[model samples]
Target chain A: MRMDKEVVNPIIDTILGSITSGLNSLQASMEPYLPELSWVAYLAFAIYVLIILAGGFMSILCRNLVRAMMGLVLTFLGVAGMYLLLASPFLAFMQLLIYVGAVCVLIFFAIMLTRNVSDGEEAHWPTLGALGYGLLALLAPLGVIGPLIIMHAGKIPVQVPVENPTGELGEGLLSDYVLPFELISIILLVAMAGAVYLAFRGFGPEKSKRHSK
Target chain B: MTTLTFFLLASLLLLAIGLAGLITRRTLVGMLISVELMLNGAGLSIVAAYKSTAASDVLGQLATLFVMGLAAAEATLVLAMILVVHRRFGKVTTKEISLLR
Candidate 1:
């Protein structure tokens, strides 16, 4: 009986451990390929970085609003790639889905809805007065904050990243972060409802006619 | 892979660009876009901090997720408000929003 129990326990352990064992074997198999893949990873990292900077500048500098939206899309894509490089593929996907998918679409709708508003002030290039304002806006934050970030960024100590980050993240959401998780859902619900109410309130032909006149 | 400094610097630049845009953008939608950019920078910095120094990876990720949620909420409210402004004021430029000025 004792011998039979011992044999059954080992069998059960093997069945339960097979998933991890498979992962270990897979990692072992890919060990040689990893060194060869390093260059590709570096190239991808560089491309993503360039994409981010270009998109940011394009969004900020472009005169046309639609063109600026395109730049925003580009930046979101680059940021998603950066998240993947940070070893969080889950966050990367979320970034793409939420930012590029939902938020951009919302902005597009807003742009289309308000496209007829012809404001000559906005259409003109920055004048001398506005140029000084723009310069102050650009330089003030950079001057005050840039040096502090530069001085301290290098001082941070990096460690070996956690294994199974995605799974752990899921667990933490349910366990440690249950409160905020629920709060987010509630906030999303309220925001959507409020947006719908605001949009449709007095949103009929009468309001349109008044605006048209 | 890139170092933490690179990510931090990237995030800082993003924030600066976003701030500049927010201050200078004449339209409500343009300002909203800049706000999104700023929020993205904040998320990147938070994750970078977590990736480098934090003991709990989940906390940083959770914060980023929360930021995303708040951003979505903010965008929805702001876009709706923009629509209302356009309907009421016939234009959406910051300069013409006389109540604010």
Candidate 2:
């Protein structure tokens, strides 16, 4: 009778272990696959993406050079918005200050400086053939690579709320990333010097002769 | 799709558009703008990754800062070079500036 009891208990425990694992698997699979996005949040995301799409379209497909530059500005703004949504407000501000205020201005300066060549009748719209080819080129990689990524997209991790990324960013910048930051500064100086040298050299005697055509 | 995946896909689309533009654009300035689009896509992806995977970490944001700096430097030098190109070649199309040919 004791032997019979021991044997039956071992069998029962084995059955319970398997059942528990099966239930665990079921629970894991049922873990909320739906992201907690409301309709409003979804709409906001769609609008931001649309803004980026419009900007990209204008930048690439527009006939007018000025319009293309405006599109670039729009794209920058949309990216800044995206950064804000991603919880990096400082990055959003930096994107605005740097891309919109500085880079676009510099680009406009270059455009004006080379207006005779860059801003002329060559501003005509891209041909349908070109657009078709561009679209084909655009879709090829997405077709080949996108499916595999989707298959393995996996579950999204829980997001941690970060209160002050800026302060942390500053601390990390000064401590761990100080060297790279200094190097970037040096590179900026070099780029500035080089740009000035190139731009100010201008239509000099030797070069103007070559551009006479 | 979830928000994270949506952002990733959007960034990917931007990258694809940039690639297409780079391939089809014959003009120097247009190509530069396309490259800028690609850089923007990269930064967005980095920021998104930080948001989704490592929300507690600031390293991704730091990387993005460096990316921005590099992009700025690239744009400056390229625009300067474009200016010089216009001065030398009388045109800004890629077909004209192929010195190797």
Candidate 3:
């Protein structure tokens, strides 16, 4: 027992000692350079992530349709904040306008159209059974996949960006991305028309008759 | 330890939550909401990758913008379809709307 303790304990101590000293060195090296503003920024990012988590939970788990829509609004806003932190202010603005403004409005309108759609219990499924299945589906794959990706992530790719942030966005869109830009606009127009037609189709005289038949 | 990895991991967690929500929710709208969460997770991951590896390339943000645009279009059409289903069947739960199945 004494020999086992001496040999095994020393091995474990060396491993733990290396990890602690490595972490300490890293902390010592970084402490001098990290600015006070970084703390605020990190704090904001933390808040944004929390908002996103709460919003997602509220939207998914809420029993009321209106509350769910509200949660969705918060989630979009939180996503927009994350975009800002990513240094893509333009994308962040687009997120606000497109997701928070347009998509949530669409959901709200649908909920109003079908009042009492959320009348039943949160779900008809047996709650515990569904939770178990849902957790099993998500956790099982993540358990198998997470370690694989982490193992590969150690290749540690390094890329240095050559252009300015917003400038690159403007140039990229106008020059290399012009075709896709116009194509997306066309797609939007088509989708808008289709949505309008589909939404109003049953209210139309001939379409209503056809649908009924 | 980098902020980039933090957001990426958060996005993955959000995606997992969304999948769980999709499985648990019986309502069509609820499922759609879960899908939205998943899409947001994808967009966040892309942006995180962009911020970390290619800060100058606007492609990542552009991809996210495209995702938002697609989400807008998808939500519009899906909600419209939901409206139609409600009008037709007077029910919104997955169990009741299995006409094709």
lDDT of each: 0.79, 0.78, 0.75
- What TM-score does each of the candidates earn? 0.79, 0.81, 0.80
Give DockQ per model, in order.
0.43, 0.43, 0.45
User: Where does candidate 1 chain A have its weakest 10-residue lDDT segment?
Assistant: A32-41
Cα lDDT of model 2 by residue, A1-213, tens digit: 356887899899999889878766664664576355444455677788999999988877765666777898888888898887777899989899888888787677766666733456346656789778899878976786667556657565646324364788999989998999899999999999999898888645867675575
Give a tens-digit lDDT track for model 1, residues A96-204.
Answer: 9999999999898888888822343345566677667767877777788777776774455565344345788889989989999999999999999999999898666
State the lDDT of candidate 1 residue by residue for B1-101, as single tens digits.
Answer: 22566677777778887888887778898888898998998998888778656557788888998998899999999999999888778888887778752
**Model 3 regions lying over 4 Å from their true place:** A1-37, A117-126, A157-167
Question: Across residues B1-101, which tens digit of lDDT does each residue of candidate 3 receive?
Answer: 34555677678767876887789877777788888888988998888787667443577777787888888878878887888888778977788888972
Among residues 3 or more apart in sequence or in different chains, the pairs in candidate 3 whose N, CA or C atoms overlap within 3 Å are none
Better model by TM-score, 1 or 3? 3
* Candidate 2 chain B, run of 10 with poorest lDDT: B48-57
Q: What digit string (tens of lDDT, one per residue) describes model 3 on residues A114-146?
A: 673556534344478887998886786467656
* Candidate 2 stretches greater than 4 Å from native: A1-31, A116-121, A126-129, A155-163, A202-213
Candidate topping TM-score: 2
Can you rank all candidates by TM-score, best first?
2, 3, 1
Give the number of the best model, judged by DockQ: 3
Residue-level lDDT tens digits of model 2 in B22-81: 777767777777888889999998888777674545888888888888998999998999
Candidate 1: Cα lDDT at A52: 86
